[model samples]
Target: MKELNSIPIENIYYMLCYSWDKLDYISRNKIGIEESMDIQNLLCRILVDEVDILIKKGIKKNYKELNESSSVVKGKINFKESIKYKSTKQCKVNHSYDELNENIIINIVIKTTLINLIKIEDLSISNRNKVKRLIKYFNFIDTILLNKKIFKNISFNKMNREYKFIINICELIFDNLLINKNDNSAEFYNFIEDERKMAYLFESFIRNFYKKELKGAKVYREDIYWELTGEFVEFLPKMQTDISLEYNDKKYLIDAKYYKKSLVENYGSKKLISGNLYQIFSYLKNNESKSKKDEFSTGILLYPRVDKTLDLEYSMDKHNINIYTVNLNSKWNEISKRLISLIK
Candidate 1:
């Protein structure tokens, strides 16, 4: 029964930024929300509040085939595709109408929740405008398919790829509502409880942030081949670093770790997670060494700052290994600067 306002929009943004391929569009668009707003109202705000940016970046209309019984001939028509004539002879001709595809189903999926929010008798006056604006956006579409069956049948494909992020957010809002349907008070939405999802988001955000900001370096999130040649080497576990930055001769292998506790007790003393360090070291050894002592790389295990700080550095085996933390809770500008400063 926690309040919806407690749900952090940052988590949602992180999830979107992680799954969505278009980071430039998402990074540029921002929306403001009150901390105490419920998920339904927050969703409404996302739709109505950011509609302009969402429309500009995504939500492009496509020419779609529309079946209709028309008075006048329209776009390419099928001679045998008329269902009305088989049932009953009517003067009206059945033909295919080519119209700019209406994303009504998506619009309905978004607005339905807004309507539900408005129906709540105890809803606050402050959120009324949000609901109204969401409804207005729905009206902007060609049609509003209100049936849940239609919404279920509709799917996003390459044709409607632009709306991917917006649709994703809408799906989250509806899925949460369905799970908590028994609660009449319209309590909290548990969208952030997925730890695996958060880990992916954190990893992806770090990778993309570096790619966007680190102009001098080429960043990649890929597997590093161990010096194994035989086919059996494929069976060996794949070693993929969260990020690998290469700027001329300097190489930095970075692994982003998302853990509730950034540090662990090792031998009765606090230390960086050994497995993370081992993984990064493995990547550095397998890929960067290349059988030459003069050729070396820096391995960094970067973690989001939690309750403790871990800024440790060690030089061993002709490589520099660093354990650092970035305070994600700080302003995003500061976070970006911290990430960019890693290579410097």
Candidate 2:
């Protein structure tokens, strides 16, 4: 994969927006795209702009259950607590009620992310000031101890759909940031060096890009079942494809890989990664066996260009397997064209 430091900051921004399905927002806002900035500054700019837009539209409010002692009865009355506290003497009652407020989970997440961003020394002074300014708008929102588990409890519906893009940005920021417990400081690490996180972003970017740009073809991730007749087949793990495109009765199963080196050295000779090849091959054969129609199936192992370019093709058992690389260091327009041309 192209090193994060070498890739243009604007290209990384575009990839992130595409992965989050916020291309429309980014295009309309056009925030800080022309500036010569690093990844931290670019992300901070986008976050500030998006949060400013959201504030203008009014932050979302959800009904949260509140439990307290009050003179007025609401929702459900807790008689035991009321009696225990001797409410009759004070003329107050204990009750649990739902109140509409801005202290929802999504808002809290955004607030926490902004606070953390301000602590990162890598961000430009201007970007840090912008983040500080945006923090004032979230005064009503509560801040919580942010963790990966907190994200799992969040769900989006029609009412909160607008928050999805912002929340995704917050999640990305959280993933790349490391917190210090001693002094409560945060450090922003270069995401390119983090293989696991970059792998996910690369995969999502490819899938969403294909879904948006490709026409006359249905794009989706598919689960391929093994073509076996044994009763103990439950022991086998499920085979899932990263990107599956179907057009003209043909299926293209793509496996997107993000690695520091596209080719590995073996005995002083560069060679294709054996494990990746085997995995894609298994996907193609099993998927082909399950189909009853005479449809042609192809497997593609797509990776980001690293040191050199690679475009190799192979055919086995009437199935075609292609290994291609997309250079992220190129211009955005060229990169987009190259990606679309791969399956075409």
Candidate 3:
């Protein structure tokens, strides 16, 4: 992938929204997103804007069980607790009741993410103030120990579906922000330095982008079975595609690769990464073997444009293989067009 800083902030925002499959929703509310802002500030702006809208629309409420001492018997009354606390004599009952409240996990994550964003030194004064203002609206929501595992516990239904976008941003903030224990200072981790995370983001962005943009095409990740059969075949690594598209009986299996260098330099000549080529080749051949389709399958090794653009084509064993690069640093429209043009 191109250096995160080098890529336009707007492009980064678009990539993130695409990865989360929230491009349309975000595009409709693009008030705070700007091309000039850095990634940290950009994310903070998005959170602040979205949270403000959420507060106005009324934060999502869920039924939470609360244990309280009350004169009225609401839910199930804890008779033993009432007697132990001497609330029986006071004419009060210890009862556990479910109350509709905004103190849910999704709101808590937003609040916690906002609090952490404030601690980052790179946050602009304007954005920091916006974050603080947005946090005030979340006063009714309780903050929790922010961790990656917290995201796993959250489930989205129709009522709370809007929170998915904001929570995704929160997860990104949680994953990338580095907080100093000594001074309580925080810094955003340079995303370009983390190849693993960038790879995931790049792959997800490409898959989702195609899923949304490809007309009448079935876009999904497909599992390719090995052609060879063995007694211990289970021990073999599963072959899963990054992005697979089927349009008009033509199959295209795309392997999205994000690396610092797109091509490997050997001796004096540059060559396509051998492992990537081999992997995509295996996916095409195995899938073709299983389906026995009359038309040959095409395999694409798609990479983010690094120092140069590459469009290499090859024909091997009746399978068409194309190694291409999409320039992420280009204009958004150009980037979209380039990606669409890949399969064509």
Most TM-score-accurate candidate: 3
Query: Higher TM-score: candidate 1 or 2?
Result: 2
Off by over 4 Å in 2: 1-5, 34-36, 72-75, 292-295
Q: In model 1, where do residues sit more than 4 Å from their true spots?
A: 1-44, 52-60, 69-93, 104-125, 140-165, 171-193, 289-295, 331-334
Indicate whether candidate 1 or candidate 2 has the larger lDDT: 2
Clashes of each: 2, 0, 0
Q: Write the per-residue lDDT of candidate 2 for residues 90-128, one digit (tens) a residue.
A: 877889999998998899999999999988877788888
Displacement of residue 282 (Cα, Å) in model 3 is 0.8
| Tens-digit lDDT string for candidate 1 (272-293) | 7778878877887788645342
Q: How do the candidates rank by TM-score, highest first? A: 3, 2, 1
Tens-digit lDDT track for model 3 on 1-344?
33543887778888888998987766588455566677788878888878888889988888999999877889999988889667435878889989998888888888888988988987999999988888888888887778767898888988888888889889988999998989978999867568898799899999998888878888998888888877999898999999988877888889998888888889999888999988998888788755644138889999888888898989987788998988888899999999888865
Query: How high is the lDDT of residue 162 in model 1?
Result: 56
Model 1: how far residue 314 lies from native, Å: 1.7
The lDDT, on a scale of 0 to 1, for candidate 2 is 0.85
Ranking by lDDT: 2, 3, 1
Error of 3 at 290 (Å): 3.5
Which wins on lDDT, candidate 1 or candidate 3? 3
For all predicted structures, in order, the TM-scores are: 0.70, 0.92, 0.93
TM-score of 2: 0.92
